[model samples]
Target: MRRFRPYLRGEGLILTGGMTALIAATIMKLLEPWPLKFVVDSVLRVEQPTDVATVIGLCAGALIAITALRAVFQFLATTVFSMVGGRVLTRVRSDLFAHVQRLSADFHEKSRAGDITLRLVGDVGMLKDTAVTATLPLLGNVLVLTGMIGIMLWLDWRLALVALVPLPLLWLATRRVTTRIGQASRAQRKREGAIAATAGEALAGMRAIQALGLEGAVSRMFRGANDRSLTDGIRAARLSAALERMVDAMVGIATAAILWFGAHAVISGRLTPGELLVFLTYLKNTFRPVREYAKYSGRLAKAAAAGDRVFDLLDQVPTIRDRPGATEAPAFRGQITFHDVHFAYDGGGAVLAGLDLTIPAGQRVAVTGPSGIGKSTLLTLLLRLRDPSGGRVVIDGTDIASVTLASLRRQISFVAQEPLLFSAPIAENIALGAGRDVTRAEIEDAARLADAHDFIAALPMGYDTVVAERGANFSAGQRQRLAIARAALRHAPLLMMDEPTAGLDSASEEAVARAIDALSADRTTLLVTHNLALAARMDRIIVLHDGRLAEDGSHAALLAKGGRYAALWRLQQGGRVRDAATG
Candidate 1:
């Protein structure tokens, strides 16, 4: 919580004005008790009746003006306070998003995406209220309480001491209960985010769960998540209730004692009847801030919890951060060289073991391997998504590890097995890399190159049509082609695609292949695919077996070698399995 203080530190200027107005409001509120004393003493007991009437009229007018001014100052103070809180929120989110973007691929491999998203949206929103309302107003209340206590002691020390009897006990209870509430609130918020993450993941993967007939299993899991949140939330609420009841008892006891003691004093003539009435008025006014403070206690605790969660996200140092003094890369010449490259996801055993390979500039190479045999890992290394554990990957004779991520990513285009598109117009997705310079002609030409323009033109809004989230409205092939169109817009020197046509039918695959060929004309491209026929069409093939390079040569030469490549090709084509030596 102390570390979370930076979220409030940027509001120095706004807090200055707010504190001034809050002090003004507090002074006006303090005027309320004195006017009751004037009414009791001057109008009822004074000698000259007309003079008393005049004095009373002036006090009434003064009191009315002060009450109005109090409202104005309170509004101005809280408004500025909220503005400052809003400014901090902007900085918090901006930093959080930037950190998320810089986080390494390996971090993503281990963390659930839905959990990350919950931190971004749910946790961050909760922190905003803490600064805007809870913390600042708490300060104002403390000041009011302090000023009220001072005035009460000045009026009569004996009466003020009587009022102080229950103060320590109430303060002690507040301290203990608020601490409990804070811890409970933080735990509750985490559980709440976990529930959202669980629900989001379940909803996003609903089709998969249904297709696999796991509806009951997913339901039970969601129920468990919901129950965890409920349990934690109930604990937080229980603490808040205890705090309220304790505060209520303390206020009741203090007020009753003041009246009991003041009555006897009025009877004894040490305190006047008018003074006793004013004492009662001050006793009630004293609890105004106390009640306000108690009311906001739960909200403040909840907000503190949320602020920590958001700051946790903001504090997450990218696991794969750029080294200090990293240099920017120029255009990629695409001569990718991996020298004794070794890597892993969690610093465990190497996933890519002593890999060594070099593909010349403008070479179109297909990497074929078993599902988990590090083919994708190789592409990750080449793209600088994860730096190698043991060696360097150099592009254009420059080690990629030394370059800035922005420039390194700029030189290469990546299309995953499934294209990730937002729910936006097709033109925006296709020309995503063009930023502010995306033109109609450029978007169409890129679309045509990916063989996606004709189908796009057939849509209701042509390129302006909105695609559903993750391109759900379009067929798989259409999404892939649109992805290619986006990559084509980059027109980068290097391209890396993973199983680009794995899920397409023959007709769809035909369209996808033509688009890829057109899009990757002169670039150095690495295509990771299990389709041996697609591998055969590439200029060269590298067959990976068990995290090692098993074969590297032209497809025809590898077929002639009668190795694993030839065996896979034969098996895929429904031909006899050859008893080949290289296999």
Candidate 2:
């Protein structure tokens, strides 16, 4: 409810109108029985047969009028409540998605995508159901019950007292069942999320699963989670059924006691038969809502469980958010510095520790290291994908953390080994991150620079050809080339390339290397690679080992000194300096 408070700010008018309509509907419901009472007392039990026809006609007309008004009021009330509930649901789901997008990368890494989707879709859907079927109805029922109880007491206080004797027991039983159902429903929702996650993961990795011959393993995992969800669902349902039965028994006890007392009062001439009948009818009408509440208790419990999960996710403060007083960054000169920077992922050993380095404006620098030696971590730090646990990363004299993330990242261009292209047209993919008004000429020029123009032109639709997810329709080399074209399109002052040619064949490697050289001109470029030949071509190469800087110099200078960088170059080239030269 608190989570929904923000979205309900302007809904007061709609809420008030709905309540008014519900009141009208309840009044009509109470009046509908009166025509029958009139017919019973004044028409059927009358002493004179004369004018009886007129009495019956008047009662019939009253019944018709009450039924029509009730229909109209009930319709208005349900419509208003449903419309408001729907709007609230939309706002809740939209906010949930936007918040998830803003959550830090580490949070995403630790969570399952499918489970997140469940919260966004399924959990919010449950809240919507609650608003319509439970919340709105409960509000109406409470008002109806209050009004009906008042009328019954006014009609005959003794009959009213007898009818309510079972109420305390009903309340106690409902409370006990509701508590257990809530717990069970929570477990049910959790297991449902697990089932969804398992199925999603398996389907997403279907290709790998088939290639590795692990279909049975994935199916069994999905089946186990599905079975748990079913069991929990059934348990919740059973508890809800029992609650309904308890409510039914209580209703029966109240009705029986009221009937026995009302009959005696009528025989004693203290109450008329028509009045007793009206009391009985009002009792049933009031308990009608109680029975409905008992029936919907299970659904409300499930909704509560869903709301808990949604709020829990919303409460997670992002680890990477712009600080207060953070200012937008100006255009960069591309000089970068790492001043005693330290970082480590949760529960993992240090990835970088007390690291110090600097890249001058417009310098072409290459970073080389063995696997898991923080080459990628350096790029992540520069992009602010994750903040350092200590120290600062500065660009053009501006501490990145002191500036807004969008402005800071806008100055840098990155191309990874695997590109994440959307399922959009090739030209759109090339123009991605290049701003909305990028010209066709600019896209073509970038494609040419990345050696992708010819291949793109060869396709039937050329730039209009739609790319599949992850650019699966294209070869790895083509995807890498398209990524390079995207970077070229950005033309940012700072560029980062990570293993751009590592997985490609010799021909593709040569093509991508040319694009890198063309895109790197006059940019403060940082290249991370295992290719010794590529390192030799850079203006300078920095080698990292055991979370510390091992060596930093030009390739020829480091080779001449025979230091760590030279040893790495020799090992990769197998002592063949000629092979390195050719590469």
Candidate 3:
């Protein structure tokens, strides 16, 4: 319900109208069964020959009128309820997606996309049935049940008492079913998420699977996930079937009691045949709703369990957020200083222990290190994708933590090692998440700066060419170029590049290097790469080893130090040249 508040506030009038219509419908329905009593006892009780036609005419007309009125309210109720339910679902999905867009990159590091996707897509949708079918009916039923019990007691108190003999047992059974269903549904959701994660990973890495001949292995994993899903579904289904059977048995017992008591009255002539007939009709009417409620109990349980999972996600506050009074940052001078900055992904060992450094405006700083040595993470902190565990990262002589995230990030642009693209045209994806009103001229200029203009124009449709899901049609180099073009278009004061030449052939690497130079012209840059030759061209390089600053100076200075940086350079250079020699 808390998760639904935003939507409820938006559709308040329509939701209220739905409640009103349901109340009217319930009243008309209760009137319908009473009419049956009148028609049976009044028309059929007469000695047939005398005025039978008139009697039939009056009762039939009244029944038709009352039923028609009931239909009207039922129609209104369903329409309004559906509208409200649909709106609520849309709002939740919208809010969830928007929040994810705002979340810090570090959150994505620790969380899987599929897990967040399951919550957004699967759990949020479960509330649909509750709102559209269950919520108003529940209120209507409470009113109907109260009215039915009152009328039945007035007719025959003893029979009414016998009819409700199984109510307690039915209530107890529903509780037990709810408890079991909750456990099963939660497990099912988790298994489904794992399956989705596996599928997502395999499909995203489809090239790797094919190259490694892992088709059979991947298929087996998918089959295993399918088996787990089916197993849980069967268990949940069996329990539901058992509950329904119990309700059936209870309805049968109540019916038998009605027949037995009515027979006694007939034997004594205390109740006429038509009167007893009407009583049986009402008894059936009473038990019909009880049967339906019993049936829908499973769905109610599903909604509850599903709702819990959804709300759990909705309730999670992002760990990183701007302070309440955070202000927009002023124009940066491009100066960057790291003062005693210490950090670790796990918050244990430091990645940058007591690190101290300063870069003058418009300087190019390259961070080079082995895999998992915090090169990428350092760039992450500079971009404000994360804040340091200790000390500070100051941009333009201002502590980054004091500025709003939006204000801070606007001063920098980044191109990741692997570009992420959307299912849209190349131009649109290049401008993705950028505000409206971006002109075609600007997009083209940015592409030109990144050395992608020539290739893009040569494509069949140029900038308008449709990019497949995640830009599958584009080569790795092309995708990276598009990413660079995107950042170039931003024209921020600082630019961050990470392994730009990764997975590129020699020709593509040269092209990308040229693009990087053009994009970073006269702008402060913090680059992370293992390409020593590339670092040699930079203004300076910082070497990180086991999360600590091992070396920092101009490329020549680091090479002369003859430590980690020099050793790595020697190993890489020898390997490349030796391989060339052997060939």
Candidate 4:
């Protein structure tokens, strides 16, 4: 409720109007039984009564008017509440998405993409639907029940007490079953999330799955999750049904007891037949809320579980955020320093241990290392994607952590080994790097610089071409070129590439290498790669071993030293020579 308060405050006036209509409907319901009471006592049972037809006609007319007005109020209340609910949830979804985006990379790495997506889309949607259908109607029915119970007590307190005897029993039964139902519903929701995660993983890796001929294995995994979800769902349903049946039996027992007691009172002249009829009507109406709860128990239980998931995500504070008094960073000179930096993933050994390094402005450096070395960790620390467990990274004499993340990252351009392109126009994908409005001519210029303009222009839609998911529509070379073009558009002072041409063929590698050379000119560049041939082109090369700097010098200098770098170089050169001889 506290989480919702902020959003609900803006809808106060609209919510007030809805509540007004709800109250009016409750009053109309209270009046509805009175007309029938008048028809019974004043017209049907009266002896020597004048104008009986007029009296009966007036009662019927009043009944119709009350029913019509109640319907109108009910409609207003329902529509207004539904509209408010939709608007509130739309904002919530938008905010939740933004929050998810702001969370640190570590959170994303640990969580399944599909489970996070389910919370964002599926869980929030379920909450919105339940608010409109089950929650609002239940509120209205509760108001109706309260009014009817009050009227019943006013008509005959003893008879009203008799009718209320089964309420405590009903509550006990509801508590026991609803608790189990809620537990089952929560389990069912988790199972559903697992199913979604499995499906998303399979879809994203469909190419790999097919190539490996593992369709049967994947199907079995999916089936397991689906079956668990079905089992829990059925359990919840059964519990809800049992509760409803219990309520029905209790209502029946209470109604029978009331009829017996009220009939004796009427015969003894302690109550009028018309009053007894009204009491009976109120008794039935009073229990309507209980029946409604029983009916919506399954949905409400599921909604509760969904709400927990949604709010849990919303409540999570981003691990990475701007600090207090953090100001925008000035234009960077591209000088970087790692002062005794140390980092490790959660519950893992250090990936970077007491690493000290420095790069002068406008210097191009290459980082080469064995697999699982901390070469990439240096770049992530610079970008503040993951903070160091100890020590700090300084840029241009200022600690990067002292500046706003947006300001700090704005001066750096990054190109990953496998760049991710969204399902948008080619032009839009390139423009994302600009971080500002860009003209079509500028986009074309950047594309040309990356050697991608020729292929893009040859397409039927050119820059308007929509990329398929993960840029699957483009070849590896084409994707790399597009990524280079994006980085070119960024025009940042610092450029970083992580094996940007790792898996490319000779021709593709040559093209990508040329574009990278152009992009790296006049910028402070850090390239991480296993290719010693590419590293040889840089001004200097640094080799990492066992989370520490093993060798640092020019490629030729390190090779002449005959240390770790020489050993790695020899291993790679030997493999290439063998491949050439075999060919």
lDDT of 1 by residue, 396-488 (tens): 899887888788888899888989898999999888955447789999999999999999999888989998987899999999999999999
TM-score of 2: 0.92
Estimate, for each residue in 64-117, the C-alpha lDDT of model 3 and write its tens digit.
Answer: 887998899889988888888888788878887888877766677777777678
**Judged by lDDT against the true structure, how good is candidate 3?**
0.80
How much lDDT does each candidate structure score? Answer: 0.81, 0.88, 0.80, 0.90
Runs in model 3 deviating more than 4 A are: 47-50, 104-106, 133-140, 263-275, 556-567, 576-583
Question: Candidate 3: which pairs clash?
Answer: 351-547
Mark the regions of model 4 whose C-alpha exceeds 4 Å error after superposition.
46-49, 573-583
Most accurate candidate by lDDT: 4
Using all chains and alpha carbons, the TM-scores for the candidates as numbered come to: 0.93, 0.92, 0.93, 0.96
Model 2: per-residue Cα lDDT over 1-583, one tens digit each = 7668888889999989988899999889888888898877777674855888898889899999999998999899999988998898888889889999889889999999889999999999989878887887788778878888898899889889888777777778778888998898999899988888887788778899999999998889988888888888899889889878877777788888888899999899878888888888988877767677778877888899999999999898888888999999999999999999898988999989999999999999999988998998999999888999998999988899999988888888999978879999999999995855799999999999999999999999999999987688998889999999999988799999998888787678888888888989999999999887876778999999888899999988899989888777778777456665777
For model 2, where is the 10-residue window of minimal lDDT? 574-583
Which of the two candidates, 1 or 2, achieves a greater TM-score against the reference? 1
Reference-based TM-score, model 3: 0.93
lDDT of 4 by residue, 336-394 (tens): 99999899888888899999999999999999988878998888999999899999899
Q: Quick one: best TM-score, which candidate?
A: 4
